[model samples]
Target: MAKILVAFDTRDEGFEKLGSEHEIIRPPKGRDFTLEELQGLLPEAEVLCSVFDRPARAELLEHGTRLRLIANFGVGFNNIDIDYARSHGITVTNTPQAVIIPTAELTLALMLDCARRVSELDRLVRRHPGESTAIGRSGYLGVHLSGKTLGLIGYGRIASAVASRARAFGMKVLYHKRTPLSPEEETRQGISYAPLEELLRLSDFISIHTPYSPETHHFIGAQQFALMKPSTIFINTARGSVVDEDALISALQSHTIAYAGLDVFEDKDIPRLPLCQLENVCMTPHTGTQTADARRAMNEEMLENVARFLAGRSDLDRVV
Candidate 1:
């Protein structure tokens, strides 16, 4: 049996399925394993159950003398050094199927929160209970969603799910990806493919779903923001590094974009000063798939990857 090192503290239900055959090392409660803590355990670990918060850099990957598989707990594997792992003959996998719906739901939630100013108004009522300023029709006006153009930055599973939800709300969906879909496929899904520039300029609501990589780092910056409408509502459920936060702040401060709803940020924790202080923006603590159902699904998928890899199966969810 292999030594499985769990770098994050997920619930024990899924891991319990491994029985007493394999040894599992877990971090302390309420925290992820630090790099230093992980390094000490790497030599004996044949598998690593990784989370997105911690960086699985080259130094850590190199220390895994017995490492065979790195099963990431989330869909996006940006936090792990995939190239280095492959170079060292180690396999890397992620729980892609598990996060699709929950992340799409979070994206929709953020979109509605920004468009309706839900969180801001809720906070207003709570901070000053029974205040008249919080009331009246003209006091806190917000945008309506029906018949608005929604642009998706990536045409992945999560983005496809978002498109379905957007269509239900009478939103016109446009998507921009590395490769445009054929006209027949577009017609079937009711989503039109547009060039990046056109999508940026025309979309009233823009949702980013692209993965983070060297080619996509700060993919949306000052120039891209400049192309957007002044009344645009921006939503990002993807990695924070995909957009330049400094440029995003500049746009928000100058009203270059009307509002932003963000689930991720460049900083690992709470965002920088001006973003936190912005009244026109709404933020979540990167809890895109924090629901109990999604967590359980991710754990199951991760375990399946570990099981398949150990059994010498090639049909598993192998990303790298």
Candidate 2:
């Protein structure tokens, strides 16, 4: 039986299938395994299961002398060193199928919250109960989602899901990707393929859903932000490095963009002080796929990858 090393302190229910077939080593109940602890346990493990937050770098991978597979719990595998794993002949896999709906749901939620200033008003209510300022007044007016245009930076599964929901709210959706879909496909989905520059210039709301990589590092910077309308609301549920945070902050400060709704941040999930102080920016602690059902589904998908690898199967969600 293959020995599996799980790097996080996750709940035990979904792991039973793996536990019955293999040896599963995990951290204690409430915390993740420390780097040192993981290194010590890696030598004997054949598969390493990692989470999105933890960095599975070469320093940690070097200790896994017997490692063959890295089953990542999230869709974005940027936390792991893909080049190192590929060079060392270690297969890397991610749970892309499990994250689609929950992430898309959170993206829509952020869009709605930013458009209506939900979080900001909620904070106002909590700070001063029964206050007139908390109520919707001329000074506290918000925009409607209807009769607006949403520009999606990446037109993948999650973005497609967001497009469907946006249509229900009477919003027009435009998407930018490496390859544009056929005219028929675009018509069927009620989305139009636009060049990035046009999307940025014409959109009322902008959302990013691209995976992070060296090629996409700081994909949206000062130049990109300058193209956006001043009334635009920006949303990012993808990696923080995809947008230059410094540029984003500058844009917000100057009202280049009216507001921003972000789930991920550039500095290792911690929002910088200047960003936190901005009243126009809404932030979440990267909780796109935080629901219990999503977590369980991710675990099951991760385990399935491990199981497929051990069974000599060729069709797995192989990343590298």
Candidate 3:
């Protein structure tokens, strides 16, 4: 039997449902797999199933002679040093397909919340002593989404899903991406490709869906915020660093932008930090891919990668 080490916190509620046959070693602490200690407990393990924490590093791989796979419980595998893992002959895989709709749905939720100030209104109602006729009129006045231009920063699977929902709501969909959608996809999704600058300038509700890469680091900064309308709303379900945190704060302070709905923070600790002090922003944990169905799917897929590897099959999610 192959030994599998689960290094981070995972309910793996899906694995039990999948009924896969394997010997699993789950860490006691939900998140105790620090680099310094991972190898000591899981010396003979053939796989490292990682959750939100960072995957095995080059130095850490020295303790991984038996480690053949690093199955990430995520879509973004940037946490793993791919090159180093490849050189060490360790395969990496991530659960991808299951989270598409759930993440898109969350993106839509954030976009709508930011546009209409949903979070602020909820806060308002809670602070007031009671719901009253005067309070209803004075508390919250939000914008409408119908007939608004909905901008998407990426045109991948999740972006396409968001465009579909936006279209159903009668919003004009505009996308700024590396490549134009195929003519067939454009017709199917009813979306138009626009220059990044044009999309930034024209969108009433701007949502980012791009991946994190060197080219995309801080893709939206103070200059980008300056291009938006004062009435514009911002939503980010993508990687946190994609937006410049300091620039976003500056823009919000200057009232250059209306509001922001963020799921992931540039610094993941922003929710507990001074950034959460602003009333114009709404944040969720990095939970776009955290729906029940998505979570199970991620867990199942990761385990299957492990199962297949032990069966003498090549690792399918190899980063190298």
Candidate 4:
């Protein structure tokens, strides 16, 4: 049996299938493996199961002399040094399928939260209990989802799921991607393909779902934000670096966009202080896949990749 090293501590029940077949090594409950501890354990590890937030740089990977595969727990694997791992003959895989539904659900939740001012209204109630006249009914009004246009930056699986849900809410969905879908496919999906500039100008709500990469870094910035309507609501559940945070902040401050709901940030899990202080923005701590169901699904997918690799299967979601 191959040695599998899990970099983070999680529910033991999630690993029952893998644990029964391999020599599994993990940190104590409630904590991740320290750098020093990982260094000592890596030399014997054949597979390194890593999380999305943690850095799996060459400095750490160099210690894994026996490492053959890296099964990332999240859909986005930007935290790992992909080039180094590729050169070192280490295959990388990610749990892309597992994150789709949960992330799409969170995207809809954020949209509703922003459109109806759910979180803002809840906060006001908590601060002024029984004070019905704390603010007039027109003081903090919210917009409606029906009859609104939602522009999606990417037309991947998650974006398609978001579009499906948005349509159910009576919102028109427009998507932009490297390639547009066929006319028949678009009709079936109930989405329209639009050029990026036109979508930004016409959309009432814009949601980013693109992956993070050098080419997509700051894909939305000053010029892009300037194209948005003054009453637009922005939502980003994808990687934070895809949209320039400084540009986004300026837009919110100047009302270039009416409001924003974000789940990810450029600083990884820690959002910037200025962003946190904004009243017009609704933020979650990158909780797209925070549900227990999502966790169990991701664990299963990661373990499947590890199992496929160990069994010499060619279709193991190999990235390298």
Candidate 5:
């Protein structure tokens, strides 16, 4: 049997679906692996599988002589040191298409919640007991999403899905992407291309679906925040580093933007940020890809990448 080191443990259900042929080395609860420990167990490990764990770099890959592919359980491979792995001929893999719908749905849900202040009101009704705001208050109250301009920072599969849902709510969608979509995609999706500044200025709601990279780091910063309307709501379902959290916190604190909804934060730990200090920004843990259907899909896809690579087929999750 080819020994495989599972850096982090996935649920038993996911493993069972992975089949029983390979010998898998599972990590313990909350136990982080040192280079020595990883080398000790599965010394001849051929493939490594994980969800969020990052393996030791440089010497670790050199030490892992038999390592061929790294099948990551999640879509983002940021946790792993990809550059070093690739240099040593180790193919890096990740589940990409599986979590699209789940993430898109969560993005829409967060947008609506921010527009309507749904979660706060729910908390008020539960905790306040007797005193409550008027249920039908208008004006500065809950804003209607219909007939509003929606801006997408990155026009990708998830953004297209969000646009579809927004269209159902009568939203006019605007997008800013490095490469614009085709004419059929524009017509079918009911979206218009705009420069980043123009889209930011015109949009009543700004949503980020961009991937995290050097070019995308701080895609939304002080300058970008200054361009948005005070009535606008900002939503980020992408990576945390894609946005500068300090700028977001300052914008919301100063009421430069009316409200913000974030499913992912620049920091993985949300409570540590000043986001909770404001009542306007609705925050959630990085749960955009956490739906049951999406989890199942990601698990299956991740395993398939491992299987495909082991079967001497093209590496499906090859990022490097």
Candidate 6:
């Protein structure tokens, strides 16, 4: 049996199927492993079950003399150094199938929260109990989205799901991918293709769904924000680094864009000071896939990848 070092604690029940076949090393329950702890454990580990919170850089991977596979716990494996892992003859895998539904749900939730002012209004009501006067239509008015345009940054599975939901809500879906979809596919999907600039200008609600990479880093910045309509409602359930937070904050402060809903932040876990302080912004601490079902599915998918690789099955989710 191989030695598996998990960087973070997860649902213990997910590992029951492994059935003591492999030795599993993990941090104490409710706590994540530190870099120092990871380095110390890697030398004896043949597999590393990594999470997105920590950076699996070359510097740390070098310490894993016995490491062969990195079964990442989440869909976005940007935190791992893919080139370095490949050069070292290590395989990387992620739980893409596990993330689709829950993340899409979170994207919709953020969009609705932004449009209806759910989070802000909830907080206001809680802070001032029995505040019936503010409930009137004249106060705290929010944007309506019955027949507005929705722009999707990436046309991946998550974005496609979001498109379906938006259409159900009477939204006109516009998507921008690196390559445009065929006319037939577009008609079937009930979505229209638009250039990035055109989508930014036309969308009443803009949601990002791209992965994080060199090309995508700061993909949406001041220039992109400048293209948006002042009444636009921005939503980002994608990697935070994809958008320039400073520019986004500036846009919100100046009313360049009406509001924003963010799940991930550029600072990994903690958001910047003024971002949380902004009344028009609603933020979640990267809980898109935090549900119990999502966690179990992710853990199961990752273990399946490990099982396949160990069984010498050539077919695997090999990113590197």
Expressed as tens digits, the lDDT of each residue in 1-320 for candidate 5 is 56778776455446564567888787776665555777676458998775654645565666677888888888888777788887888888898888788988988898899899887777667876777656664633878999999999998889989999999999999999999988897998799999999999999999998999999989899999999999999999898889989988899989899999888877664644477777887888888888778878887788788778777888496786
- Clashing residue pairs for model 4: none
Query: What order do candidates take by TM-score, descending?
Result: 4, 2, 6, 1, 5, 3
User: Candidate 1: deviation at residue 272, Å?
Assistant: 2.3
Cα lDDT for residue 72, candidate 6: 94
Candidate 6, residues 1-320, lDDT tens digits: the string is 98989898887756765567889898999988999999999999998989876789998899999999999988888889998998999999988888999999998898889898999888888898775736775778887778999999998999999999989999999999999999999999999999999999999999999988899999999999999999999999998999999999999999999999999888865789999899999999999998999989998988888878877787777777
Q: Please give each candidate's TM-score.
A: 0.91, 0.94, 0.89, 0.95, 0.90, 0.92
Every candidate's lDDT: 0.91, 0.92, 0.81, 0.91, 0.83, 0.90
lDDT of 4: 0.91
Q: Judging by lDDT, tell me the better candidate of 1 and 6.
A: 1
The reply for model 1, stretches above 4 Å from the true place, is 16-20, 27-37
Task: Name the runs in model 6 displaced over 4 angstroms.
Answer: 16-20, 32-37
By lDDT, the best candidate is 2
Clashing pairs in 3: none
| lDDT for each residue of candidate 3 in 241-301, tens digit (9 for 90 to 100) | 9999889888887889988888878875355354578888888887888777887777877
lDDT of 1 at 269: 48
The digit string of per-residue lDDT tens for model 1 on 1-320 reads 98999998887767766767899899888988888889999989999999876789898988898899999988878789988998889999998899999999999999999999998888887888666654676877888789899999999999999999999999999999999999999999999999999999999999999998899899999999999999999999998989999999999999999999999898774588999899999999898998999999999989888888877889777889
- Please identify which of the two predictions, 1 or 2, would achieve the higher lDDT against the true structure: 2
Clashes of 2: 0
Model 1 weakest 10-residue run by lDDT: 128-137
Worst 10 residues of 6 by lDDT: 129-138
Specify the poorest-scoring 10-residue window by lDDT in model 3.
Answer: 12-21
